[model samples]
Target: MGVVTSIIHKKINEEENTILFFGRILEYKGIDYLIKAEPLISEKIPNIKIIIAGSGDFSKYESMINHKNHFEIINEYIPDEKVSELFQKSSVVVLPYIEASQTGIIPIAYAFKKPVVATDVGSLSEVIVDGVTGFIVPPRDSKLLADSLLNILLNKNLKNSMGSAAYEFMKENMSWKGIAQKTIGEYQKLLGNFEKPRYLIGSLQ
Candidate 1:
């Protein structure tokens, strides 16, 4: 996922676009919310383009986005290799999940140093610090989501600043190497504190 975001970031940078979103096409993902907010966002930035990748049942939300032609919907299960291709083709990666326990997708956005606009649900807030790495809004609020998205898209300085901060955060904390070392240290401590059982030699004799 990180690799994909990096690719998308590179490409979008070349095109000078502002934002993007990548992930599965699940109902819980809040595509409906994004679709609903499209017109509101477009009222501000008419050129704003939202690229949605990954396949799922979007028939219900299709009508919602029909009038707003600024969105590009890739309605197919993007393969692992193709993920980077998609990511490289866009700007910011949005994750508006209604429920989550720590998302693997967040790390990918961090990897590309792409600023995020995720809902303040579950562990998402823990991952994305509002106004720092990215903005976090109340879940199911399309207006707030649209506002955040517009803010990032319109403000290049803020977008770059947040992206840099996000990248630094990932480098300092979320890397696989750092996680492995921390996990190993915890295991070692647990093993060192483990007690050994004593045998009842007198009873056996």
Candidate 2:
């Protein structure tokens, strides 16, 4: 599902240490936290490239970006074609949302075999197994967010391990078949009927 490396990310120049914070830009998405974490991350890995892509007015965030030279901001709609390339070039995907109902970004990152660093918001915690698929930090905590991102960026084995786990998690849990199976299991447990229903059977579809 990966596209050949493209100019969008090659322009970052340092793909290995790159962290992606992509998706629609909005106040509740906590771009500020990622910005605050930059200096903290730079203190350890100096040449890190942080790519912030998606549509919205980014001018409001100008004041927060202290490491301006290290950041590549795409403050307009990104085409569907280029998304996979962006994910492929990134070492980790970060979700620093202060508030969120849910997000589809984590699965996309996993599909690229990329690990995620997300804040505890909405259903993100349910999908991202902390320290396994990715690390889950507290919302709006820049230091912890920085720490989690640094963990994946600095450790190659851990990053790959987590990314692989994330991909498997997505594959096994996100599939309709898996969902239906789990649903059937839950019904059996709820009704205390572990035995297969022979007399009265029903189809899930």
Residue by residue across 48-89, what tens digits does model 2's lDDT show?
A: 999999998788999988879889998888886668678878
In candidate 1, how many Å is residue 114 off? 0.3
Q: What TM value does model 2 have? A: 0.84
Which pairs in model 2 have colliding backbones?
A: none
My TM-score estimates for the predictions, one after another, are 0.81, 0.84
Pick by lDDT: which candidate is best? 2
Candidate 2: global Cα-lDDT? 0.85
Indicate the residue-level lDDT of 128 in model 1: 86
Candidate 2 segments exceeding 4 Å error:
1-14, 188-205
Indicate the TM-score of model 1: 0.81
lDDT of 1: 0.76
